[model samples]
Target: MIFFYTARAKFNNENGADILAWTNYIEWSKLTQLTELVSIDTSINEVLVETDRTSEEDWKEIVIDGYHETGFYRTLDHVLKKKILKDLIS
Candidate 1:
């Protein structure tokens, strides 16, 4: 099993205003969600959604299907990796 930390912001405003609170691994959608966020940043290579606010914090364990990704390499051997094979070729 593989587990990656995902952090989401709870803002006082709807548009992420004031970062009211932070949450870790709210769901298993990072396979589809993280890719979008990471690709938006040019200098970033990977999208790290954390369970905590600190950059060094870690999260729970999960079997990540790295396949359903968009703008990066999919090297994981798990089921999630299959999602990116199609996107990778293009």
Candidate 2:
């Protein structure tokens, strides 16, 4: 059972003022609705997605199917990793 978190933004104004209010996840098979799938190479354990945001322009490609994504997507994973590591090394 795979899951992915999706950030939801709440707008305070019509002029684009908004805040990331929360996130949610769904099964991997259901991710198609949110993003456009580019390619999936099982041999290399790689899956790529087309950029849906202008901020992602610099990244020629993005791997959406991962336990920890490489960029902003890993924010929560990074925090969790720090906490787990602290406990283990303490």
Candidate 3:
């Protein structure tokens, strides 16, 4: 499966800090691909994933878990590059 994702930072008034939030748009041709990618690329201790199977769109929503926003972004960049290269070669 191929997935597309975007992330952003939002300010938390109560905490007076910025939090990392990511929204993953997944192409569900293969269900396990995202899991595999996340497992291999990240070492985040607790991961939470929620899927919206009821939507009638081609892309489904997936939320990835990570406390370190910058680290997650770096991992995402690396994974995307690897996927692109694999796609191009094959």
Q: Pick the candidate with the highest lDDT.
A: 2
Instruction: Output the TM-score of candidate 2.
Output: 0.19
**lDDT, residue 58, candidate 3:** 13
Q: For candidate 1, write residues 1-90 as lDDT tens digits.
A: 633332222222234432222122223334433312323342322233312224221112232356432332222332233334434755
Estimate the TM-score of every prediction: 0.18, 0.19, 0.20
Clashing pairs in 3: none
**What are the per-residue Cα lDDT tens digits for candidate 2 across 19-87?**
221112224345525322222233212222222446443233333546544423334453344445555
Candidates sorted by TM-score, best first: 3, 2, 1
- Provide the RMSD of all predictions against the true structure, rounded to 1 decimal: 16.1, 15.0, 17.5
Residue-level lDDT tens digits of model 3 in 1-90: 644443322222223332231212233333433432333233322222212246332122233355323223223554454445555777
The C-alpha stretches of model 2 lying farther than 4 A from their native spots are 1-74
What stretches of model 1 exceed 4 Å from their correct place?
1-4, 14-63, 70-90
Q: Using lDDT as the measure, what is the rank order of every candidate, best first?
A: 2, 3, 1
Cα miss at 38, model 3 (Å)? 11
The TM-score of predicted model 1 comes to 0.18
Worst 10 residues of 1 by lDDT: 50-59
